[model samples]
Target: MRAPKSHVRVALATTLLAGAALTGSAAAAGFAHADSSRAGDANIAPVGRADLHPEASPLFSVARRLPKVSADQVLRLAESQVGVRENGYGGGTKFHDWYMNSPRARETVARDGGKVTDYRNAAWCDMFVSWVGDKLGIRPAMGWDAYTVSHASWFKENKRWGTHPVRGAVVFFGWDGGKLLHNIDHVGFVIKDNGDGTIQTVEGNTGNGKVEIRTRPTADVVGYGYPVYTA
Candidate 1:
């Protein structure tokens, strides 16, 4: 028997509404699942730190604090190379190899007009500074110019140039009476302030072609190039 048309219409409308409700609930469940997955991902830690108990991790101990690569580390690294010596006039193969292999060495060579082999038999005071900066991961801020004049200019341009002595600062020298940016002849890392108007520095390519720690009066220092190191 055929039902009334109004009755059939009401039944059809009811079915459509029921289907829409079910579709909305499913969409909400999918959204909730996605949110839960994101929350789980957020709880995950770095690989090495995640496996260890919180107290067992090396980062847990204050006594076992790792030294960050900063100014202090740079000074220490430079000091460690104190006994390194050149074989002859402009002959420090170790220093040369370090400079040659550096990421910025080619740029330095191009700017300064020197070959990789020439560095082995070249003035390497600047090269030593470049090597230290590269090793410490501060090359972008410290610069790796093969010439002191060029390095000094970079410092001045970047506003890292200074005068007062600070540990780990690179000290540029100018023996000639002219502008420091133009006359810079050598560079080194400052070790101490000396507290008496002088600074003790660890310099490469000094005194018989050997790395040496020397004391220099502040008056003789042209200026200092400060690296952007972590405080």
Candidate 2:
């Protein structure tokens, strides 16, 4: 059979609690112990919290230091990074390989150290975002799973992604492409909004190629979440 939605919610909640504890960051999104039973029960209303920093210019400064990367820049990064590999799903693609193995993105994170980029792992997008969170000085950003769980809770409760992209918006992708049962495997930052329903992002493990920017269709986006990276 399949795990009931309630079980999934409980598992997700447990993951969030453990993740938050590991990162030593307090739950400020007002989602602490969110009752998943209430999820999607109604059209969500706008909810805000002090933990999530508001969008601002300084948030984009770190990305600007790079080569003026835009949506296209991110797309090129993804295009160059896409990899054909054998995975649990048989011949599959691995998008996060670059964060661990790529010399360019790794070098950027190593040199910057919580300033330019944070590279938690050379090959995982979650780690890449964790490093980015550190560069931006957000403590909870370190826990890859927590970041995801928190965002999931936020979405389950709020019903809409935040207004604008910040440094650490939880970028979610379908594990098997819209198969919610697979859980989310990819996450990253919004490098730029093309303003035409496309977004450029810098993510790790985009593939064996390298840590780079890539573009994906936002029309089918399942989730867009943000984390408190700064005060």
TM, every model: 0.67, 0.44
Judged by whole-model lDDT over C-alpha atoms, candidate 1 comes out at 0.59
Best by TM-score: 1
How well is each residue in 27-57 modelled by candidate 1, as lDDT tens digits?
4433212232223232222222232232221
**Cα shift from native, residue 104, model 2 (Å):** 25
1-231, model 2: which lDDT tens digit per residue?
A: 111122123334333221233222334432333333433323222224434332221212212222222233323433444343324321122323333343333333332233112222123455445444333333232223213433454343332244455433556665455635235546666666678877777665554534666786664345666442212
Question: So what's the TM-score on candidate 1?
Answer: 0.67
Give the winner by lDDT: 1
> What 10-residue stretch in candidate 1 is worst by lDDT?
10-19
